[model samples]
Target: MLTVELGEELLIIKSEQPLKVLSSAMLNPGIGRYQYFVNRTVDKNYYPEDAKCEYEQFLQQYTMPLQMTVAMMTAVQQRFVMREQYVDGETTIDVFITAGLGNAVDVTQSYQYTYKPAVGTINIFVFVDGDMSDEAFIQAYHCIIEAKVKVLHERGVIDKQSGTIATGTSTDSVALAVKERGEFHAYGGSITRLGALIGKGVAATLHKAIDGYDAYQKGELR
Candidate 1:
């Protein structure tokens, strides 16, 4: 099972048991066994000379196992975070996301200049029940990124610098956690059931998070 908690400064996703995780988080990046994943909300103007120290300090507030946690930071408020879950037979996928487009960028564009302080970012955290092979874990991560970019394209998100579709924000981050139990799945792709669930869950949650952020920006949501 997975539990999600939204606080003023943080969005936390906790699994009942330790999970094998592959992540691009600032803290604890790479494959490991983790039980807690956190997305910390920082100011839009946040810029730190020592990011590692910054993350360490922010994480000290919680009593969680610091070494067992994967953490990412975003400028989007935690209140605007969105979540979705899909369950089929013995498989379950849970997705949590927060999005902001202030620093959107096209992956194919090469820019000499970029936004300073990088105000916006998209952070995604996904937890899947059951064991997954290392190869499948990486494949699942790719599926999540693909789903995110697809939604951005469908939404017509533009990169102001390149005047092209934005693939994602410059600081986008994602984490995939798979419970280390049950059958060891070997494949994760758009055509696979597990991958389909991941894609669907990520796409749905991202759409809601984007819409929610837009509404908040326009004073439509409080």
Candidate 2:
């Protein structure tokens, strides 16, 4: 089983066993086997010239083996983070997301706006209780990205600079983790069962997170 803990400034996900993880996170990125993943919340105005150093220093507060953890940071508040679980027989997937659209963007367009402190970001963390090959893991990651973009498009999220549907925020990030146990999967795509579950879980969780953030912005939610 996987456990999720929310702190004032952090969200932590720990698995009963180590997992094969692939992520584009600021801390402990890339493909690795990990037992823990984290999303730390920073102030919306927080920005550091050396983000690498900032991540390293922030991680020092934890006692877990840093190498066994994958971590990402976001400006979204912890109260707005959302989670969803999808289960199909023996397979289970958990999706956790924190989203803010202030920096939404259309990837095909270019902008020359001055660099500013972080205001918004969308960070996704997915945990699957299944064994997947390296190829399948990469495919699952791609599927998650597709789902996110689809939801943004459907929601009519527009980029301020391009006036077009945003594919994602400029600082968006995701981490996909698959357990080392369960029936091995060779392919993970929208058509496959594993990928389908992942896609649905991410789409639902992300949508809810965005809605929650919107409410927060309007003072409808705290």
Candidate 3:
């Protein structure tokens, strides 16, 4: 590690022989007299401006879909209260719209949360990243809620201490959903993070498509 003092900031460069390389550095008069390579041993080179243009073009595709996703989140939060502190830490996504296929109506926004108590009358927070259509969102949501509730019930996430049906103001988990229809929904419905996983099913489809009719033998793809 070697520190070279730039005009304002010091940049640390890693090299086997920093001082020797710096001594033989050539000051290229491009944009500014910035020494990109320590020595004249760079395999290839291009003008900085050219490289910048290429990078900017490459980044344009990712910008729109990510932006669309987040913008929808903000709008949804105003009406539907979801998991508080959604999209916290870990992987923070920045989505921008790539394209809206036909009448698909870009309802691609989503958010996630992990409530501590996980049940009872509580507000589930959501952090969205795009604008969503109300019709599509509701349709997807109700389907998910019903499916999850059934699965959760079968999986024993909701069951009374007694063997009989839970009734008479003794709503534990089911009551939570009834009270907070928009928030704290049981199981996952539309507009849930599970959709993200489902979205990635495209990758699996592509893999299968590309590898279809493969000639594999001896535990190796051919």
Candidate 4:
């Protein structure tokens, strides 16, 4: 089962197919969503380029429930701390699952839904230590933390406890938090690949979670 939770929002994927990411194309909304050529404004804070710096990202035809994407989404969320003023606020984000455009540069695309801003698809809510509502950041953190823990658990980089999160620590704190006790296995190569997936997935999921307004009724929004 693949679960995506933001605050109280939830998106559970129980499909037999593994979560897949075909591609990642990015566009920045600079001038309040109505301005043209937003990314070309040429101002410091007007529109900063993506931290990744890649114009387009293409992925293997992996299945859904992409644990990596989930991890990245979590990290992006944690990148910012909400301030009393909106300037300190985080940017809104969304994710789309398009079935087409799998094998073409000039392909047509269809978006699936407008993900609600909350973490989970459900309506549950969370309160951070402060009176801030940075649920997006918190949820993204959870995704990275969980995905790292999962990776370390698989690679035996950290010890884990059965029926619970891992018990040992890794240089990667997120992975360490999910430590468990089990047979030690070392696969640094595989672990590295998985770690990349977790990191990017966290960012993507963060964008999708806060993207679109009517994501729950994805069909309607589409």
Cα lDDT computed for each candidate against the true fold:
0.87, 0.86, 0.22, 0.23
Model 2, residue 100: displacement in angstroms?
0.8
Clashing pairs in 1: none
**Candidate 2 on 1-222: residue-level lDDT in tens?**
888889878998888888888899887888888998889888866778998788878878886678888888888777778988899767888889999999888887745554344478899999888788777888899999999999999999998887899999888889998886877778898898888888889999988998998898899987
* TM-score, prediction 2: 0.94
For candidate 1, lDDT tens digit of each residue in 3-46? 77889789888878788898999999998899989999988767
Better of 2 and 3 by lDDT: 2
After superposition, candidate 2 runs with Cα above 4 Å error:
111-117
On lDDT, the leading prediction is: 1
Which ten residues in a row are the worst by lDDT in model 4?
Answer: 32-41
Error of 3 at 8 (Å): 44
| Model 1, global lDDT | 0.87
Off by over 4 Å in 4: 1-12, 15-143, 146-191, 213-222
Better of 2 and 3 by TM-score: 2
Cα lDDT of model 4 by residue, 57-164, tens digit: 311232322233321121112112111111112221122221110011100111223222222110101111111122333343354545433433443331111223
Clashes of each: 0, 0, 26, 51
Model 2: lDDT of residue 28: 81
TM-score of each: 0.95, 0.94, 0.21, 0.19
- Model 3 regions lying over 4 Å from their true place: 1-119, 147-151, 161-222
